[model samples]
Target: MALVETATFECGGCGTCAPSTWIDYDRLLYPVCPEYGRATGPLA
Candidate 1:
């Protein structure tokens, strides 16, 4: 069997979805994280 790769992106400014950790196997990268500025939730 063969393997396939794909990339996905999302906006962090508006917390429409839950945050996620990023992983890059090809290149070395510093620990990257998303910054949620404004969000609407039950706690808000």
Candidate 2:
């Protein structure tokens, strides 16, 4: 299984992190990059 890591963000008190597209929530949900998902090695 992929060992997922968390991302930190600079938010505008909004429910999102721009560019990275990571959501701002009371509890976080990680958004994997499309390229990262396509990678088929250790993280696959």
Candidate 3:
């Protein structure tokens, strides 16, 4: 059997933020604004 893991992203700002699916990555999740690329967060 193969192990499959999944994760989700929550926008640190308002719930209205939506990030681009194309740029989705592990490191980019933190300190990034969902609507715009910026440093700020607790993305875990």
Candidate 4:
């Protein structure tokens, strides 16, 4: 089984400053922010 880990960060885009979650896997970083509304891309 593979291990999973997560981290929280602050979003400094869109002037909202919402909180974001990041998952760490295989040395890769995946960020999730509410400002992006479930999109996998960066905030506009």
Candidate 5:
């Protein structure tokens, strides 16, 4: 048997409206997380 995963992303271009904060991650850059509802998780 085989397995697959599905993910979705939505950008509202709310950079100006987005909150201003400092977040540290493994990567130098961070990913954009929209305010609106979205699905994100691991599937098996």
Candidate 6:
């Protein structure tokens, strides 16, 4: 059996969240928000 820690990454004030994308160069755990676009920082 396996467990997942988090389902999605959320930015503050968005009220929504999505899976994160691996940015190789910058090495950031970030999400691509539809309404607000890409997040500037990783989740805290």
User: Which numbered prediction scores highest in TM-score against the true structure?
Assistant: 6
What lDDT would each prediction earn against the true structure? Answer: 0.35, 0.37, 0.50, 0.41, 0.34, 0.50
Query: For residues 1-44, what per-residue lDDT tens digits would candidate 1 score against the true structure?
Result: 88955554344434333333342222233322244443322333
Displacement of the residue 35 alpha carbon in candidate 4, Å:
1.7
lDDT of predicted model 2:
0.37
Evaluated against the true structure, the overall lDDT of model 4 is 0.41
For candidate 6, write residues 4-36 as lDDT tens digits: 775555656475555544221223644445556
- Please list the Cα RMSD from the true structure of every candidate, rounded to 1 decimal place: 9.9, 14.5, 6.3, 8.9, 13.3, 5.4
Clashing pairs in 2: none
List where candidate 2 sits over 4 angstroms from the true fold. 18-44
Poorest stretch of ten by lDDT in candidate 6 = 21-30
The C-alpha TM-scores of every prediction are 0.23, 0.19, 0.31, 0.23, 0.20, 0.32
1-44: candidate 4 lDDT, tens digit per residue: 99975545554444434324342222223344456533233332
Candidate 4, residue 25: lDDT = 22
The lDDT of model 5 is 0.34
Candidate 3 per-residue C-alpha lDDT over 1-44 given as tens digits, one digit per residue, 9 for 90 to 100: 99965544455564434444423445654445545655456544
